[model samples]
Target: GVTRSHSRPKVSNDNPYSEAHFKTTKYMSDYPERFDSLAHAREWFDAFISYYNHEHRHSGIGLHTPASV
Candidate 1:
């Protein structure tokens, strides 16, 4: 329901929420500070999304993967 609203810097002092979510989901406690400079973060984010969509089941989605549902 709540999507990007403030494109202007004045309107939104905080960063865009979707971008923020991506950064949070991609970067976590276990990941290295520097992941091969660039490839590492991208690779990990890809893997994480794959696992989240396919391998990781959620009860909220009737216990089915988001892709499957």
Candidate 2:
């Protein structure tokens, strides 16, 4: 079964966790100003997802990587 968010329309703060992740991605030093192509974007996101799950530590999760949790 899947649950749906009941947040109001046009509410950007409806999901704090996702907002936080977006902030982290935007503020990354290596983040590109613009991806060259769809393939390039995919490659970058694949690497980013790997690092986010395997290397990035979250304080809310007791500083453990998502993969370790």
Candidate 3:
């Protein structure tokens, strides 16, 4: 689903965009610091993916949710 950007020469800033998104997920108040079990992790991941795909607005995609995009 990723829209590939025109292939430009690699640079350090290339990673910032993805890294920032990862930081946002990691720093979310509801994100657990630890998971008790595989089941628990799966549950959390499912919920997060649901919200991320259906609700979270991605600025990179013109402020639209991924599901909508």
Candidate 4:
């Protein structure tokens, strides 16, 4: 089961990593405004995750992809 955070609402500082990732995901030029279907959303996320882990470089990791680190 997924654990729920007990932090107050509207507070994003508790998880800076996820907040940064979400910001990146939303700001992508290819990001869609809406998903046409559940399958579509899943497919999009799969591609995004692949690119994120394998190709995207992170400054926090010295500009290396997560998979390489």
Which is better, 1 or 2, measured by TM-score? 2
Candidate 1 local lDDT, 28-55, one digit each (tens): 5665766785788788878877877887
Candidate 1's displacement at residue 69, Å, is 0.5
Q: In model 1, where do residues sit more than 4 Å from their true spots?
A: 1-30
Estimate the overall C-alpha local distance difference test score of candidate 2.
0.88
For each candidate, what is the lDDT? Answer: 0.70, 0.88, 0.83, 0.91
User: Can you give the TM-score per candidate against the true fold?
Assistant: 0.51, 0.79, 0.68, 0.80
In model 3, state the lDDT of residue 12: 54
* Colliding residue pairs in candidate 2: none
Return model 4's CA RMSD, one decimal.
Answer: 7.8
Residue 27 lDDT, candidate 2, scale 0-100 = 84
Write candidate 2's Cα lDDT for 1-69 as tens digits: 988985465685578778789888988888999999999999988999899999999899999999999
Cα error of candidate 2 at position 10, Å: 10
Which TM-score value belongs to model 4?
Answer: 0.80
TM-score of 3: 0.68
lDDT of 3 by residue, 1-69 (tens): 889886454775577767767776788779998999999989988888899889988888999998998
Candidate 4 or 1, higher lDDT: 4
Kindly report which residue stretches of model 3 are placed more than 4 angstroms away from their true locations once superposed: 1-18
